[model samples]
Target: MEKQSIEQLQKICTQLRRDVLRMVHAVQSGHPGAPLGCAEFFVSLYFDILRHDPNFNMDGKDEDLFFLSNGHLSAGWYSVLARSGYFPVEELKTFRKINSRLQGHPATEEGLPGIRVASGSLGQGLSVALGAAQAKKLNGDDKLVYILLGDGELQEGQVWEAAMYAAHYGVDNLIATIDYNGQQIDGPTEKVMDLKNLKAKWEAFGWEVNEIKDGNNLEAVLEGLKKAKSLSGKGKPVMNLLYTEMGYGVDFMVGTHKWHGSPPSDEQLADALGQLEETLGDY
Candidate 1:
């Protein structure tokens, strides 16, 4: 890709991180850490990798689909979609309210653009994305399916089941990424439930796994994604264990699971915004 494209994507990622913080802090409830952590990955997919239209239709027959298995990070998804022109950015403030389309987790039944399936229960997104990939193949469409899962969420049994199914069935059109941020709600994933051999586990399941050390780095994410795309259609599903800092970009929230699901208070929000520029202006 061109330098200009990389620069643009980096800028967009920064702004998306800002939106994730601001929106979560405003509501005083939401998952900011994961969103901030996965900002670069989401930026790369929406602006560079995924072929999607801003005015997305519900059918999604022609567009590449993205499934957020760890749906608690809806703030990041909403911010990216809005910045990418999927919908009005003004609707972000209505997140988690009584009747807003932007809920804690995404639901297609709510008529939300850029989200095909409702996810929040965790560990189910890969299966959903795999099913979508199968549908794409049946229709003879070459569009790819992308799904993001949390490292802690990997402890779920269903994830491996889906992984085995995808590989055994030769679902080569899917690319699954793990936000290996090392932290989750209760504590570190290792402490909660040791994932001593994450890489080995994916490989054992027959996935072509790649690792990116710094998921917060936009350029690195783009390059890694390009590599993942190149490895697609190789008879095995592609998986990337993206190393991210949970609650990245904000010093206070970084390196801890405390801010995983809790929103920052007003003062904390002010502090966060103070640290981050209003690149696209606060909505």
Candidate 2:
């Protein structure tokens, strides 16, 4: 594949970040921090990196997969999926509403085309991705699996179990990214539960690790994702310690643990939107 220009992808990342904030503010509920923090990486993967159709049918036959472990951040995922044409952009308005496909957490059980598993509880996605990776190999398929987790989710024992299993069995087709934004629902991850030496921990687990200087910077994320792609198929699973601001772009939301899972008030929403451009047009 030809390399994508970082400048162009930066514009797209800006739009995706706008979409994430708009969706969350519209619903008056959901997690914005992870989405805001990881927007560039999501844009890098969906628009500029991953190989898959937006109209993906989760048969696990030929498509690459994205698993969202921090399911509360579904607003951003849904926005990106819609903007990327996975489903109609109109669906974004239904987020977190009863009977809406765009639920508070992603679930394939609802026949959502792009999502492969339900992941609101956290920490299970990497294990699920590992299973899919092994299955893909068994089927002679070379498609890759990508999973994103919050830094807090790493505290789950299941994540380490999946980590051990992937390294032991050589699940080289999987790329796991941790949203190292520091803040969680209660407070900063350090205050809530210290995950000291996070990168070193992944390296110790036998995974190849890379760090993105700024997760919110589209150029940097695109470059890091390209590097991650190059490292694929090298007989080691990859983990990225994505360093990002907890709530990026909007000044009121950035660097705060309070916005992790809370909704913006009507006044706050207006204030937040005042700081962003409605690049792709709001849903």
Candidate 3:
């Protein structure tokens, strides 16, 4: 894909938000909150940071690799992948439907052009992304590996184990970002399990840490990503704590955990759609 201006990237982000809302509403199923929350991050990664091939290589021999740890937010990843030219935008209509390649969570059995592994089980993506980074090093690929994880998902012990491995082994080419929306499917993440001092925890684990105060803002996300890239190859992994509202664009859903996995009703969908402009003309 060609390089896009910041204005163009923002436009694509709007379209992606629209796509997430509609896809979840169409199926009356699928998680929408994190996807809506991380729209700008997805837009930033695909359009600006990632050095990937839209042509779809399973091995990704010489390209930057991305892993979606919080796979419930597959809607945003799917929309971005489509918009980034991995697959036809029209394929989004098949999301969550029987026999559709776009499953509720990303899977590889169906041979989706852009997906490399199945995900949805939390606390596994970071390890997988680290493994990919190791493979790249083994092959002398000289590229980065990126992963997206959720704050709530961090309650799983496996996440910390992966953190230890990354730091211990000096996985310098790996970058991970967390969607710190403070909300999860059941309720607030704090109520579920407190992750206080998240930044300090990562720092203690021997990784570089950065923060994005407004993940919904395109400029902020781009700036954070650029900084993360600069921090790479320094003998330590990097993490970006991206603070975001659970449902950013929609008024009623913002900052609440209720929208975490709930599909909006027809009336509610209309209301949400009103908040976003039809940028890129929608998928």
lDDT of 3: 0.93
- Over 143-178, each residue of candidate 1 has an lDDT whose tens digit, in order, gives 899999999998999998999999999999999999
Ranking by lDDT: 3, 1, 2
TM-score of 1: 0.96
Clashing pairs in 3: none
> If scored against the real structure, what TM-score would every candidate get?
0.96, 0.95, 0.98
Candidate 1 versus truth, CA RMSD in Å, comes to 1.6
Query: Of models 1 and 2, which has the larger TM-score?
Result: 1
What local lDDT score does residue 78 receive in model 3, on the 0 to 100 scale?
93
* Global lDDT scores for all candidate models: 0.88, 0.84, 0.93
Candidate 3 ranges with C-alpha deviation above 4 Å: none
Candidate 2 lDDT by residue in tens digits, 163-197:
98988998899988898899888999899999999
How many clashes (backbone N, Cα, C below 3 Å) per candidate?
0, 0, 0
RMSD of each: 1.6, 1.7, 0.8
